[model samples]
Target: MNVEVIIVLVALVGMLAALIMDKMRPGMILFSVVVLFLCTGILSPKEMLEGFSNKGMITVAMLFLVSEGIRQSGALTQVIKKLLPQEKTSVFKAQIRMLPSIAFISAFLNNTPVVVIFAPIIKRWASSVKLPATYFLIPLSYVTILGGICTLIGTSTNLVVHSMIQEAGLKGFSMFELGKVGVFIAIAGIIYLFLFSSKLLPSDRPETSGNEEEEQNSTLHLVEAVIGPRFPGINKRVGDFNFKRHYGAEIKELRRSGHTYTDLGNIRFREGDTLVVLTDDSFIRTWGESSVFLMLANGKDYEPAGKKKRWFALILLLIMIIGATIGELPAIQRLLPEGIKLDMFFFVSITTVIMAWTKIFPPQKYTKYISWDILITIACAFAISKAMENSGVADLLASYIIGLSHSHGPYVLLAAMFIITNIFTELITNNAAAALSFPLALSISQQLGVSPMPFFVVICMAASASFSTPIGYQTNLIVQGIGNYKFTDFVRIGLPLNIITFLISVFVIPQIWSF
Candidate 1:
């Protein structure tokens, strides 16, 4: 009824329209929305800038550096090499090999980067043994969807929901806590891929060039490696990697835990680690035969997969993640002194200091690793969501839903909420979807007199249920563009995947979390 509220509604509509049209970069659109609100006096300039001050926003930023450190250290690169399909000339065999880790890694890392690192590599591998790129690309996106379910930081949608829950005076999930359910879902998905992906995934296009089915595959490689717990490179420098001189393959990227790194030399080596290297196939095959580095893809899980070094980045990553998770626990939160958090800023500073001193990611260049656009988008999203709530739009919708479902039990309420949120996410950014849905989930719980647990789960699942459209989830979009896929391609595969996700979340969430 108020003029300000009306303005907020109109501005939100404009924002959504901009996102759908792909009219401008999402960050730009959100910034414009904040500017419009300020000029119209809808939100004070201070309020518009509040998102930048958010601990959650900073935490997201730190995650990027953490990811960067892992990559530079050559951790993820080994993991990719070991997991890819063998060049045995069997399409099904390779798909089976690659899908599981692809799915698992996607769950913990930002799916887009995983694809960026894997797509070309996998495509090339596919070509080496005469497999189609189309078959792998779809599965790549699908697995990311499945894996994202397992961790608090596995996807931005999860973090956005966690932040919303905390904002509403509720405790959020712990890191890998969601893995209890997510891993099961991933296992089932990998099974599905193994049994059906080869048959159902399209390979209509051959490996040949320019028959029109060719033209966009084979830009990455699968080099094997393993790091023992006591390599001197654990916190050492890339310049120390004598293997580069010997193996003739560069450590193009690394993975530790869920992060990826491209700054190779600065990364110190570590034990129990793996790497994915990008080199000519002939070089990989020749090296695999010689046994210079233990080839994980060659069946040694714990062998030194790459040249031995003296460094360890995984320990720091584990400390930050575990520390942050425990700190988030209610009892842990109580024990801590006031005003401290395990946030992005906290971890970013901590990780950066370690990496800088080790010359891993020199502090001067550390700034380059952070994805500022994503941070800006996140900050601006906060302002837009705030405006929606302040204007009563979110409350109005929540009230309507409460009336419609008052007679129904929480099961129907939970299912309805998840379904609605899932649909909304498919159309817009998942973080935005969670932000817009949070108030409604909380208000409805208040009206129903039930604990908000079920609603909270719905918000988490709905925000991440990005199965129906590539337009909504960045990971899907990246693969689609790189894979050169048609829009309907996602619709055909994604619709069923969405249904499975919804069914599992709706049934499993209440059972697991006790709504």
Candidate 2:
């Protein structure tokens, strides 16, 4: 490697360390690396800023609002009620009923909101049916992730990869193209969960007293709130923050990773920590929409939109998906204006505007709905990928990979790429994993003189196959805290699913897309 590659590689290692250590917000950590690249003359101003304006990044932002509108409408909550068993049910039966429908919903919408909406409800339902919430919550998060890979709009990572393909002067993934392989993976993964998840997951029941249960049924609510990056009290001692004074809620307990702290003395707050707070009726009304918390577990706290508004929001979402799908057809492309294309960006933008005008979500408070930190992380991820390519680091790494797997052929290379990407995703952000792996995948394909499509598909699958760790995916983190689970719980159950997804992606992707 030359001086530039050495510099980029050093920076890459430091960035990964910072991200793993939680030294700063993921967005800032990624943005810092991009700035380092810019200062070292490895990236231009246009290249540095290009990700901020990427169509994929913008679509993610718009989809956030669309998800928020649907979330506020209470449509998802309504759907969950119907999916759960009315009376007591077995864990296997519950998974059979709930997992597939959730997977389908997640394929159409964002995964975080679906988990945020369904997790608490499912947990509560599990309690009602005398089943362990731990058995259901992890599967809920995993199924959404499985569903997301089924379509272009299923997850932000897919869109990020699609945008990179377009920028590389190739046609991006059409709607449902990923579904060819993704559907099979979803089916196999779900079946595995149905058979083994109940036995593998812990049977710990949520602790509650008669008085606490009565209070829950009354106006007082015990809420589980996940700390967001924007929360001001992060990194400070709980005693110093004065939670009751600021948010008008009492922090009765806090759960971090898998440990529960009821004393709350001298505990420093961290992002993603779940706080079980005792709140009155006005608590959700006051902070439900705030960005301070990633999600509030009390779905019954909010007054959903009117029936007409709820149906309207659902119809609008379908229109956006259908419109974007149809726009990609060759006939529709030919009918469009010379300089214009009716892509996801076009449809999502229009749908967002209509929702705002019609008051699906509050128009004035729209900025709060968007996760700016994630947006920043994604934008910086693109720049980081470009820097790796420009500095020859991607080529250097690709050559080594090809050298190790050449005798075994592309099948081995595909497995190696999947393993590397999946590890990065398990340790850090999924988008960052995709960004880091994309250039390398492209380089490997070019070196082998094969289609890059299978490599790209593998990156998407591996980056999203973050089933083995709670930190790998946001939804996993959400469920981990509420379920009071240990890190080993994920390893025990999720590791098998990880292997299953890996096998499916390696064996099935090449068959469908051709190497």
Candidate 3:
């Protein structure tokens, strides 16, 4: 490799290390790498800043607002209440009733908010029915992931890949084109979870007597909160910070990884740590939307919009989805004005404005609803992918992969690509994984003289097949904290689902899309 390639490779390694070590926010870590590439002369100024204006990245930001409007309307909350069994039911029966609907709903919205809104409600319902919450939480995360693969706008990773395709002067994904392969994967994966998840997941009943539980439930509010970067006590011992005095709550227990500690006197607080706190019902109302905590469970403080408002929000979302799907048709494309197409960016922007004007979510406070960290991470991911291609690193890696796998045919090459992307996603952010693997996929397809569609589809599936670890996906981390699960718990159950997805992608993608 020449100097540019060597430098890119070294920076790539350093980026991976920083992301794994949790040294900084993922957005900052990725942005730093892009700046490094800019200073090294591998990328022009426009190339370095191009990601900031990417249509796909901007679509993700708009979708966040759309999701928030729906969330504020309490529509998702209403759906969960109706899905849970009113009477006692077996875990299998509950999964039958709940998982499929959740998957379908997730296909249309952001997965993290779906999990955030559904997890606590499901956990509370499970506890009331005497079922273990652990059995359900992991599956909730996995099913949302499965659903996200079914459409172009279902997940940010798919949009990121689509953006790269369009930028390369090729046709991008239709709204539902990925559903050809993704639907099969979702059905098969959900079936696998139904058969084995309850048995594989641990059952840890809370330690409390009937009367004590009854009294605690009636009198005190038990809430679970994850620490955020804005938390004042992030690096201080609990005793030094005086949690009860500042937040008007007592930390009854602290959970990190799989371990639980009751004596939190000297424990230094960290982001993502789950704390089981004993406080009054007013606690959630006081800090529900505050930046001090990443997420607060048992959120009973939110007020639902009026019935008319809820219906309006749902109808608006449906219009956006249907509009985008129709806009991709050839006839519809021809009817549009020159250089103007009615795509997701167009529809989502329109929907967001309508919602904002109608006050579906607060109009002036709309900025708080967006996750700027995730947006930055995605934008930087695009620049990093461009750097890989500009520096010759993607081509070099593609050549080595082809040398080893070409003799076995393109099927083997697809499998190799899936494995590499999956590994990166399991260790780092999925957007970054898709970004890094994308250039290599393009290079490999060009060298083999085959359509790049299958390669592109596999990257979407594999980058999102992050069932084996909580670290890989935000939804998994949210569920892990709320359920108090061990790292090994995910391996026991998610590893099998990962294999199932891998097998399906390698064997099925080519059949549908062709090399």
What lDDT is reached at residue 66 by model 2? 96
| Local lDDT at 369 for model 1 | 63
Better of 2 and 3 by TM-score: 2
Q: How close is each model in CA RMSD to the real structure?
A: 11.8, 1.9, 2.2
Q: Who wins the lDDT comparison?
A: 2
Question: Best candidate, TM-score-wise?
Answer: 2
Full-model lDDT for every candidate: 0.66, 0.89, 0.88
Which ranges in model 2 have alpha carbons more than 4 Å from their true place?
A: 208-221, 298-301
* TM-score of model 3 (CA atoms): 0.95
Q: Which stretches of candidate 3 lie over 4 Å from their true place?
A: 205-220, 229-232, 240-242, 299-302
- Model 2 Cα lDDT, one tens digit per residue, 314-345: 99999998998999999989988898888889
Candidate 1 lDDT (Cα, 0 to 1): 0.66
Candidate 1 lDDT, 145-231, residue by residue in tens: 778878877877677667767766787777776776677667766676667666655563321112121123354444445442223
| Evaluation by TM-score, superior candidate among 1 and 3 | 3
Order the candidate numbers by lDDT, best to worst: 2, 3, 1
